[model samples]
Structure formats: structure tokens, C-alpha cells
Target: MSEATETEKPASSSNTTLTNAQKARIERNRAKAENLRQAKLVTHPYKIGPNGGPEGNSVIKVQGTKYIDSGGGFLLEQPVLPAPGQKSNAEAETPVVIDDGINIPVKYEECLDCGDQFADSYLFNNFGHSVCDKCRDTEDRHSLITRTEAKAEYLLKDCDFDKREPPLRYISRKNPHNVRWGEMKLYLHLQVLKRAMDVWGSEEELMRQHESREDKREVGKARKYNKQMKQLRMEVRSSVYTKKTTELHVHEFGPETYNEEEDNYTHACVSCPYTETFEKM
Candidate 1:
């Protein structure tokens, strides 16, 4: 043979046998390790998607030369999809972790809120929790990007939310007895938009460090508050999704509490384009 690679590693010449107790101990240790691995809170460095160039673009030579001469197979077209009831070989088989000598360890991760186990690669940008992709979709989310921040904040603080608007109209096709179902839906949607302010307020407080304190006994209280607020924000996307329509009844600011200087807000989404429609009304 020209050379034996890792995939072709030879088996040990000596035969070995383990006692039942030893085998049981190994199984126990594996279970314990798997549990601990799933409980990790922070993201690991190695568990990342392909970010750079050549390594990420895994280009296999489809058509190459013999020695240095000709070409190969697989290229020029998009991959063919499998038939309805069929699956790719990779999906059909059960997972098997193999130690091909070089060693690629199996990985597991868990969401903090839902405690669901998933590959770390499926992790999404969670609002305030160590959540998975599924939880991230439902949890309240606060997007702090350059594009969304201004609009979200305006809808949060300056909007005159408490000002009730004209009721929305919709039809119920299911049953005549459920004719008012459309009205109930409108109320539900209104509540969802109102919650956007709640999410926005929590985020603002965390950023403003309003919860921060300098007392001898409360030096770290602010940080703890910040964490609580951050976690609370993770539910924002879910709140927004519950009622998708945008309207002026959605309030982000008022005089009763949170911030004292926000007196200009009259409980509605004003100054914001969302309130422009209500300006004439």
C-alpha cells in the first residue's frame, strides 16, 4: 500500500476486554459529560460558521487533470432535490460520531429560556436570553441596529399611545354568531403594539443605567438590573408578532411613571410616521 491515512488507521494488534462494571462507569461518565455540555450559558469560540474565504468556500475539484492533466465529475449545475418521500443519505442515517484519529468532538448547546437542546450553529441573535432559533422567534426582541433603533425608539417614547383611535374593521367568515370576532382581533392587535413600548422602555432603562446605584451595599445592583432587563427584552419579537398591524393606539410614553422628562408624549405614537395617519384625525 502507498500509505495508510487516518481513515485507514490499523486496529490494535492486542485484544482487550472490559469488565461489566468498567463499561457501566464509562457510560455514566458519558452521560454526565453530555449533561454538563448542554448546560453551558455562554457561546464557545470554536462553534462558529465559516466566516473567512477559502476554507468557508469548500470547493472540491469536480473536473481535474490526471496527475496534472484532465478534469473530474460534479459541477456546472445546482444540486438536484430528492423525491418527496426520499431523503439524502446523510439525513437517512442515524448520527454516528467517529474519531477519525485527528478528532472532531461532538457538540451540544441548550437554550436558557426553553432549555431546548440544539447544535450551537443554529443559535440566533437572542434579545435578552440565551435562546435557540425557535425560542428567538417567539421571545420578545429588541433590534438595536442602526436602521431599526430610531424608529423603534420613537414609537417607544414619543408616541401618544393612550389616545384611543377609531376602531379597525374586519369580517368574520366562520359563523354569524362570531360576527364580533373581527373586533376582538383588533383589540388583541392593539395590545401587542402597546407592548412594543414596554420592550423599548426596558431596553432604554438598561442603556441609560437608570437602575444603577452607588450605595455601599448596592454597588453591583445596577448590573443585575441590566441583566434582568436584557433578558426581558428577548420576548419583544414575540410580542410584536402577536398583532402585526401598526396603529396609533400603540403607546410608548406617558406622564404616570418611568421617565420624568418625557412630558411631551400624550400617550400615542406621534412625531413618528406611525402617527402621521392619526395627525389629521
Candidate 2:
């Protein structure tokens, strides 16, 4: 009896120990059975009409209750239809209420040109200038100027436009002259003029500075021209002379000869074609 029991225990242990694949398959089968049981709990209580009529179109009448055939195998229970003059449960649920009166009033800005309060305008939105769109004059007063033009005409530096107390606003645009060039920054001409006045203290001061700079520029150009001419002359003179540094020809004269009329001793260099004449008392 003891020997038989030992053999039976080994056999039972071997049978109980399942492989990984067998375990996974058993788990999958158990999950499928549970899903089937859950599906059976909710009986599709709708049914189709005897004839293919309108009643069988979008609904399935299983047993007695009407179930919506949602195209797929799934069916939805028919909700209790609300009587006439009554909203459905979905419609009866109050929608989120947002009172417009509770919202804070929007602050309107006074337009510089029109003197009318406006909530939004192109100039106000882009450049912070409280001007209405009707007063926006792209051709003159409210015109846009390129950064280069602003710098040249107003004598404003990068700091004036960017690093000043209140930096000027600008819009970036693709270079109109050449798309390959870097983007161009455009600023309001009116703002640039105002900034220029601030930088130079007044329009008169700006004009005086312009005149001074122009005179200095002319003087610089003249000086540069003179320098260039001087360099050109030096180059031409050097080319003509062809300066050479050869060992000095120490007058290795054969003999010093006296001139009869001139009364001077003359000597010629033997190594180079150089001659010298001198008078000695």
C-alpha cells in the first residue's frame, strides 16, 4: 500500500504541473468563457418584424423589447421614450451655464486719429498704437518704415529701437527686394520719428547733428581721396625707379686724371659704371 501511494503521488504531481503554453491557453479559455457568460446575462430582448418592414430597419425586436441594432453584433437597450411635449433625459440635463454678464468688461482704447474708443485695431494690435483701422494711413502718417530707413533717416541706433526703456515694436517681413536676404524688420514711422526726437532732444537738434555729420563725412572723403592719390603716386614712382641695393662700388680707380681746362681730378669706378669728379686745393 505504501509503495502504490508513492507511485501515485509522483503521477499526480506530474499531471498537475502544466507547461507555460498550456497555462496561457487555459487562462485564455477561462477569460473567453467569462465574457460569454456576461454577454448571456443581458439577453437581446428585441426582434425583427415578420416582413422586412420599417420596424425592422434600424432596430432588432428580440423576444419582445426593441433593441437598437448598432450595425455591429452589439445591441443597445431601447430607452423609455419620453411622452409628447417632454424633453429626453439627455436634453433635460441642464447644459453648463455661462453668464455673459458675469464676464469682465473689455477695456477699449481711444483711437489717436478718430478719437473713438475701439476694442481692437490693426495698429493697436501690432504696434500698440491706439489707432483705429479707419485712421491707418499706410502711405504716410501711420506708414511702416524699414529698420535701415529708420536708422538712416532718424539716426536711431539698434539700442534706441531694442534696448531703450520702452523698446519700439516692429514686424518682421520677408525681404521684398530679395527673398534670399534676411528678414526685414518694419517699424511705425510715427514711432520712429518720436524716438528720434527723444534721442536727440528735439527735431532741431537732430537736424543740427545731421548737418555736422554730413560735414565730417565730406571731410573724411576728401582725406581718404588724398591718401589714395598719394599711394598711387608712390607706387608709380617706385615702379619707374626700380630701386636696387647693390654693394657700394668703392672707386677702385686705375689712376686719378687731372682735367686740363676744368682743373679737377676725375675718377671712374672699375666695378660699376659710376664716375666722380672733384677739385682739391
Candidate 3:
């Protein structure tokens, strides 16, 4: 090699300088990472992931935000409550106890058809069998027009306000159109039923405790435990219930669906007797 010139005797460091484009790209990446970090911090607010430290700064994280269906091909960007007319998949999946002109749902003891709650002497059915006031009235009016009898007899079996209905049953002409009314029951209030369920759980716990203490030989102690169990049973039997009415938009009357010949006249001739059928013509 030739001898170096006076001013260029030694070479500078060999590290390559970054171009303007490269620098700009690096800056954009850094800003994106910082924004992600801030979002993660906001969502969690407690602790960051394992790669949150400065030593692991290259690993960027984006917090997950819950999304709901927007009825489009993609999910909504943010979470939102379902629209009033729409029901979540979860709510729609619950089993419903359907009745004539009504639907009794244990969720709120409201009518599945009209979302009305049961109350008072308007109806007497066993648990889980409920018809709303409006639906029941409609059915009664329809029954008056269609049933063989003007008013069906209601044999009261058990009746205690908010707690129990008198064991009630009625015998009609045993028509194929009507169901066995004796075995059917109305759904209790949701919150009250929840209370009863909690009481049942407590009763079970108490029973376990009683069983554990059974080894003791005190006759009076046994009596006390028996009394406790009786009380719990009575509590379960006498649990309070509720009645509520909620107006929800439901499907209109359709002979093929909502109203059959059994209760409504949609599919039957209006002036025809209960024994009569509509002509195909």
C-alpha cells in the first residue's frame, strides 16, 4: 500500500450511517410501540406482560378490547350493548316454557310472548307454568268464545300470596284442545326464586353440618337439629315470589305459529263452535 497522505493518515470508524428513510422508518416504529404500550397500560392498569421491561423493549404489545357483533362481516371496533330489538346469543339460548298465548321464562317470570309477569287471582298454575295477564285475558276471551263451557271451574288446592298457590285444579270436559291444568304451574319471581335457591344451598350446608354433629349423644340436641331442618323446609315451601310486566316487541299473531285452533280463532271460523273445524275451501 502507498503511504497515507498527511491529512488522511488514519481511517475513521467503519460503522455505516443510517439513511434518512431508514431513520424515519425507525422513528415510526418507535411511536407505534409507545402507543401500544400506553394502551396496554390503560387496559390492564395492574401489571404489564413479561416483555414489558426496557431490556425487552423491542417486543410491543397491544391490549385486547372486547368486541361485539356489528351484524357485518367484521366485529365492531369497540364493545357495545346489543340493540333493544336484538338479543344476545346467550339470552336467546335460554330454554323457554311456552304456554297458550304466553311464554313463561324463569329468567324474569315474564311472558315469552308479551313479557308480562303473573300476579293475583288472574291465573292459578303450578311453578314454571305462567301466562301473562294480557295473554291470559286474551285466552280467556277466546276460550269463552270457543270453549264448550262459559266459565271453567277452578278448584283451589293451595294459595299463599307470593309464597305458594293453593293446590288448584279444574276438570273440564277433557277436550283434546286443552292441557291438564292441574300439573301446570306459574314461574316465581326471578329474584325471589334466586333467594329460594340460596336458601336451599344454605339448607344443604346446614344438613351437612348436622350430619357431622350426629355423633353427639344429646337427645335435646337432636331435637334442635330436627327443628332447624323443618324450618328450612318450610322456608323453601314458603319462599316469596314476584310479578312484573315488561313490554317487548314480539311477533304478531299467526295461525301457523302463535295461535293454533286450540286457543285462538285465527285458523278457525270465528262463529264456529268449539267442535267445528274450518273448511279447507
TM-scores vs. true structure, each candidate: 0.18, 0.56, 0.14
Off by over 4 Å in 1: 1-100, 125-129, 138-281
Candidate 3, which ten residues in sequence have the lowest lDDT sum? Answer: 148-157
Cα deviation in Å at residue 280, candidate 1?
39
Supply the TM-score for candidate 2.
Answer: 0.56
Q: What is the C-alpha lDDT profile of model 2 across 131-239, one tens digit per residue?
A: 9998888898988999999999888899999999799998999997899999999899998998998899998999998999999999999989967875776677665
Per-residue lDDT for 1-281 in model 1, tens only?
A: 54655435444322356678989999999999998976543332223344421222223344551111112332332233456688975676868788678767766677776888776523332222245766654223522222123334334332333333322122223333576543221112223344554555655654554334235337567768856765565466357547768664655532222333522223334344332111000
Candidate ordering by lDDT (highest first): 2, 3, 1
After superposing candidate 3 on the true structure, give the runs of residues whose Cα lies further than 4 Å from its correct spot. Answer: 1-16, 43-281
* True-vs-predicted CA distance for residue 177, candidate 2, Å: 1.6
